[model samples]
Target chain A: MNDAAGKNTIERAEPGEVGIVQPRDFVSTGEFVFESGQKLPGFTLRYETYGRLNPARDNAILICHALSGDHHSAGIHTLADRKPGWWNNLIGPGKAVDTNHWFVICSNCLGGCQGSTGPSTINPQTGRVFGMTFPFVTIRDMVRAQKRLIDSLGIESLYAVIGGSMGGMQVLQWGIEYPAFVRKLLPMATTARESAQGIGFNEVGRQAIMQDRDWNHGDYPKNGGPRVGLAIARMMAHITYVSDASMDRKFGRKRTAAESSTAAYTFDAQFEVESYLRYQGEAFINRFDANSYLYITRAIDHFDLAEAHGSLEKAFEKIEAETLVVGFTSDWLFPPEQNREIVLALLREGKRASYAEITTDLGHDSFLLESEELYEIVRGFLK
Target chain B: MNDAAGKNTIERAEPGEVGIVQPRDFVSTGEFVFESGQKLPGFTLRYETYGRLNPARDNAILICHALSGDHHSAGIHTLADRKPGWWNNLIGPGKAVDTNHWFVICSNCLGGCQGSTGPSTINPQTGRVFGMTFPFVTIRDMVRAQKRLIDSLGIESLYAVIGGSMGGMQVLQWGIEYPAFVRKLLPMATTARESAQGIGFNEVGRQAIMQDRDWNHGDYPKNGGPRVGLAIARMMAHITYVSDASMDRKFGRKRTAAESSTAAYTFDAQFEVESYLRYQGEAFINRFDANSYLYITRAIDHFDLAEAHGSLEKAFEKIEAETLVVGFTSDWLFPPEQNREIVLALLREGKRASYAEITTDLGHDSFLLESEELYEIVRGFLK
Candidate 1:
């Protein structure tokens, strides 16, 4: 660990009880010595269990969220007054990821702006916000941090690890970096290695954040720190995430409010797509930190699963996990071909796997949308 | 002609040289008296002379350009020094719409920022930038203006009126609105109607322009007037003009010179895609007015042949012109189906027509690419 040259006031998540074993809830604590040799202290990991964890604790399922999701998978919770997490529709109350029996956990990934060690956290060495000093994180680093979290919880293995889009990417990373820990895997609407298309989109979003005048080299807490930039970035991503057809059916050329006069060509949400994107950008800044948005998206763009394992095929060589890959038909951002390629890679490794391509115009975000068939497929696959 | 409300200046074209002597390059202008009871100014058409106008003035061709193109037909003369215009490869010498035998005329369209009476032109009544005060122009309105230019030049009919994308829309509009004006019509890589999807993209671009701080609601010339917004708008349009593969091959994850560092992670143009977009945006703004971008793109969004002429078939009812419809294999913006629909419309109208679907991954901008085969197909059809 790096030396504690100058210490001052610091705070972190204290060890807490398991708080009763609910199928979709899991929490634990650990420590991580980062690549920079800086030690992260009292890392509290909060996760939720879904479906059944087979007798061996081998049926344990681990889920990872995108940029702004947290551990409270799907249930009634009294912690800090927020609603039951974002993906609750897909993972709770007899849904695809049922809480009837399986053990599911989705911890806030490392470097996340949430309850994770991030730029918002204070540096023990200097007693100041990590800010620009925070060590760069890779998908491997995040998965490694999760591994420590799982180890601390006394969980040796997982039946399946699932994620989509960025989360789907994390799923691939978990499988590539630590094959033995995963017995099953589902990476939906994602790629083994983000193609040039995915990387290009992410890069643009990152630039939007960093170019904001307030960014100040990622050290601008004194100012608002790139909120508008973050909002623009979010708006661009929102367009890519949803399909054109979906956007058309939902928004169209419909004006924000009913047009009162033909002469009144005012600055308003004249089209449905504009209104939707505006809402998306507005809502994003509320829950996400601009700096964290920049950092994590950069990490995603930097991710290369094939390079991580030295070869694309080699990445899956030792994977014994039964894979259930899901892809949405209209996801041009991370199209079906990307997910199909993932399934092909597993097949090349001669691993047990199943693949389903869902027809939907929800685009890269089809995974996040509610579709009965996708739910049915997941339920059966997990069972 | 309704009172000259506020007369200022009148500079007619050099009488003898500009207009063609043959009747083949002509089309009578349709005058649509405005609600304001004013007879709008007429078109001053300019065209090229080809081999013999076939002794019957029947082989005259009309070429049309996309959003930011002009009347230059072919070659690199001191008078024709606009970088050979957009379709240089397909027009000069013995190429498609060959100047060898077919007289080709490509005029600056109505409501264009390019040396035409568009939104930016000074209104004689106010002696100020017309801006939003300029009358709205439809695709058909442009066709009507061009018709006057053709008639004033002594052309009564054309061998063909050919164009791709927005220009294609004009070809279709001309064939329907003024049947006697054309002998053959080609609508290449264009749709019967601008899809809700395409309109959505345009709307997003417009929003970017309007949202720029310097954009004084289309009246901020002294303030540098929305250059950033216009650049961003161009950036978005550039994405639609190319296929994903093209972007990956050309740009991928290359970084800009300013952002690269031995240690620090740079976001500025770090990806080749970023550099390409920035360059496209910067170059685009140099030649385009910010407000003009808004108006022209909206004109495109509002262009739907079927919307104006009822059914796609009815859209071609009175056309006696032979037609050649063409499409690029990779043009998702206006794919093969769009071109096919135009051909189908002509066929239903019993007008002679041919359709060609060129296989290329150059996307909607394929017509602008160096494709000799595409030129050959067009040349043979025109001949």
Candidate 2:
């Protein structure tokens, strides 16, 4: 068995579990330049890896995370951990991105609030949180940072770069920025460019956070800023992440018995869906930084491959990755047409690309949900 | 020419303009009991009417306004008015609602803020603004209050009742509450019951307002409560009112040149869509009351015709009007299926009802927009 720092050498205690994995930090002392021409003297990226790289190092795959995801894409942090990593169901020994056969690497994105250099991270020069001082980071900047991490790990070429939503955008950026370096690309539930509706929704969330008095111009102390605003944003964004049908199936007009007294009308979470959303918002504020949300959503809004490259087809012209773009049938946020558009652009450029659509009621978040259909598609694509 | 108070007898210098209509108030000294058994000792409803009431009083058509709408459904208030009343396109002379042929009566909803006895109005008993003290009012309650106004006007409401969105909910209530009073019922872009997704969105808005410190538990002075919160709510809710395709068509990724500087990333509205939404949010706070928004949305959330009447068919069992429920194809908020569901229940109950689906990119607000198809549908249905 390999004893490398990246490899999960620990024996599995449960089926398909990459048990007892640990996150490591990669601090790059070299200057990093952002897409907006802003520069950082140095940066740290927190990452976790599973399985082992073969002698040839051709089995390395990179996993990118969505808006709220992080480096802990698989495996339990500790034995007492209540939940495994976000993508545990699909990223273990025998899972879709089987750790038994491939070396998997996942990192917190460049402007992420998770264990990465972000707005919440302290500026080494000033010894204060970067806050609004953190430079604008785009999907391209995120991929570029990951490229540095990949280079540090001595992986010259990647077997695949896979992700969904914002992560999917980075996967696309990987194929375009380092065409020959990534042999395969799997992006799901994402668009080449965020739609106007997407921008509008993001703006609402941004406004919610910015308008909060506690936000204090993004200078508030840790865990002390815009709790209500961030929660409200999450609650609203949570709705967009789930399908209307799914919500109806899950919550309907079912009132919370505890809150729905016939005595009087009050502005409380009376409906089960309202209660669930409020809970989601509350839970989110505990983990996420409002400034990071503003930064990340801004990145998403600025992601327009077509606009950047003159045309979507032109953007795919240099892509060497064998791309598989998966779209969810009920994902209204980044609908099937948007996913299909990516493949269509690739095909128009004569690139090796295909599209797979999974029918699910999970909406934009279908990629994170456990689905045998999605599993089969991913497994088969990687194979 | 009839010189009755409801008639717009003034000369119309502009084509199709109702021209200089005036708002009037109806005072009800008797106690008004709400659906939840809460009582209002007395109330005043601000209303406006266009066209003359025929001698038989059967030519009067009751027009209902949506959540943010008011009594001024048609005509210019004065020569200096920047814009005519909302729905002016459809409610003017020779238009779809055709003030030339029908007396159209519209009132600010009972719990509404626009010069109506609502949360923003004074409570005679306490000598303070009703604020959160205003009793919970449902679609049925609003309809009941309007019925009193109609009775005081010496009208039996024999012609028709028409509205969209929240107004549509009220229209349905009118048909059910007084089955024999109304002749034709035209409700568009509304649902028999607000879906879980709908409730979730409403909850987000409520949370935004309630979380605002300036809301002061709904006791803030008139024009001074939760501006930021109310604006954020409006901005988000406005997005739901329009479709993705419509937003794409309207704003796309077009960055506002004045704001899109390459110097640095700022939270200021950069994208045209973002700028537009900010404008929407800001404008909304100037006109809407935060507490009124809470009460109305709660009323909408509580509107469950099926559950309230045991079943949807049971709810439609007493409908004596020839009803036509129009659904907009792009309205994701209250999709065509939801609108069709109402007609389906009516059909199951063997009632005179039909469904019309207007293919448009306007989304839920398609009913309010200028569309020949919708106009034709409304005109033909009313005829």
Candidate 3:
């Protein structure tokens, strides 16, 4: 069925049948004030849900997506679709997240462009799109927006809040901001605060986008965005998502046979890895907004639970949820040490906390990838 | 004295005085052919020499440079100049690469723009800048050009061939291509060949430059080249050059005082690291040519000494030099394992080989940074 926004609603199928959910908008009546002292007047949050909410409404698990991810957390949108949802590997009926048991809620984050009220959203004050005028959003602001969605759904508390990367930031934010409302927390492949090196990388990506002439100071024409800049940004970022070992295993120095039988040695995409990265960049430009990328990444870079709450131990003092902090061994972006910091903080707070460092060459993306180890840990924790 | 091309010759100072040498151009009369089936009619290689050649003419040590480096490896250009040569910290009198004991030769690599025939150099036949027309030059090609320079200097063999990163690649090439000419080889923070991850990074940089509209297919106006693209590329490369631990120590999450006394939650460079990277990018744009960057990075990406010589074991077969492979613990770009690979191969060939894995947080740039351990190693090995 179609919602008022013309977006498709969740399709319920047989217990074992894999099903897709379409994003639906929840328009808030009041203004949402941001940490930057800016406000959005009656913004809309786009979200999707799978499975059925139990009569008690306490079986709801909120799934937070990472950077460049959205409400599509599981299943395929259409039969012809080449790819399933971003976390389809983890959130399927029989997968780690197990939508069959818990009512799953996945929302496009605030400051995101995928059907959410973000930079491309039309400003109520002005007749044009918000462009760069959109208020800056922090992880807390995103969680607050998500909280509003949960409140509207009549869920007093979530069964679990699970996420990786920026999503994991939200999980930590939930633990701090609305501790009582999150019964269980699984923050994977993330840190309490963004590291200097991580910030440096994000800054470079933002600079690449901002420097493009076509960006037009973040007010590019509707159909004409900063493709080159965005592509370059994506190419740079894509490198950080996977480890060196993973790249070696996947693409290596294997040359694209069509480009040059030998070494054409021109600036062409000669290596298979280069070709893969180029494709990622081009594909990213098609799906993502440059301004949204800028805003979301800024939010991530600004994240610091310890800074906000005075200290790491102090940040978890109010947390009532049973937390499971997970990290990927190869995740250089948010190393396991950073995840251990959170676990240690939680332990110091005298809260029930557990940690697992999943060894994988998959890097930061290991949280979403299908692995028996991750699945067992997630299933055991959720149970 | 002024050369025929108006380039200044190296100035001879008093015996004990540490003095900077001016770059002198060595014009090759015959055509210079590239590995990519492209040819240069003739090329002028710009190089700097410090200290005097001994009576035996075998005290010569050729110093190869990494990406973005040039002929000025040590000493200050002028007495009033604030900055000494890039490696002045390690290449002065009584330093790791002592000028007092050795005649040091540093040259702008074959595809370099600094006082050398490169993409920015005018193509005689076309009466235009070579731009993208410059033939692809490999690590072997760079070493070959150095060979010509050495022959012209009447040097029968070099006392040592020393370099790090791309320069290290050149050192390996020298061991295979001109085994008898290089008596000792020190290849630091480098691999026998470029890794998939390394190639991927270089490709991203090249894409960033090529995608810029101002690049104009690598034929941009002399004064109006792709500054933004070049800056972004430099920023990306800079991140790889320094370690995560180093960045944390240097910049941390410390916010820039101007952007926000606290976190403004804005997209602006709130972090000091961002400011540092921006400065690096801007400063790099002032000194480097975009086309030269493209060509040089390509040469690095295409470097595969083992592949050229059939295998790693075979590559070291002709190496007559006593080799020392140096690696920095924190260098993820060219990790210690890669350095160990070379040492292992040399040992397999029954050659005089030693390896030193320097404990440093300086990353790939550790070779240029001050370290007493490295100093002792170099001093002992050279002696």
Residue B53 C-alpha lDDT in model 2: 85
Measured by TM-score, how close is model 3 to the native structure? 0.96
Model 1 ranges off by over 4 Å? A1-56, A67-73, A76-84, A114-134, A207-228, A251-257, A260-267, B1-57, B70-74, B77-83, B253-264, B348-351
Whose lDDT is greatest here?
2
Work out the TM-score per prediction: 0.83, 0.98, 0.96
What does candidate 2's lDDT look like per residue over A1-383, in tens digits?
A: 22464455344547678998888888999999897889999899999998888888899999999988899998888888999889888898889999889999999998898889999999989999999999998999999999999998888899999999999999999999999899999999999999999999999999999999999999999969999899989999999999899999999988788876664566777889988999999899999999999999999998999999999999988998899999999999999999999999999989999999998888999999999999999999999
Q: Is the docking of candidate 2 incorrect, acceptable, medium or high quality?
A: high
* Model 1, span B267-356: residue lDDT tens: 455655777777877888787877767766766766766755677777778888888888988787887876788788778778798888
For candidate 1, the iRMS in Å is: 3.3
Query: Using lDDT as the measure, what is the rank order of every candidate, best first?
Result: 2, 3, 1
Q: Residues A118-161, candidate 1, lDDT per residue (tens digit)? A: 77666767877778677766677778888876675557887778
Top TM-score model: 2
Would you list the clashing residue pairs of candidate 2?
Answer: none
Question: iRMS of each prediction in angstroms?
Answer: 3.3, 1.2, 1.0
Candidate 3 residue B105 Cα shift, in angstroms, is 0.5
lDDT of each: 0.67, 0.90, 0.86
| A65-180 per-residue lDDT for model 3 (tens digits) | 99999988876677666787887777767777776677788899998989888999888778888999888888999999999888887788899999999999999899889978
lDDT of 2 by residue, B262-341 (tens): 54566787889998999999999898899999999999999999989999999988999999999999999999999999
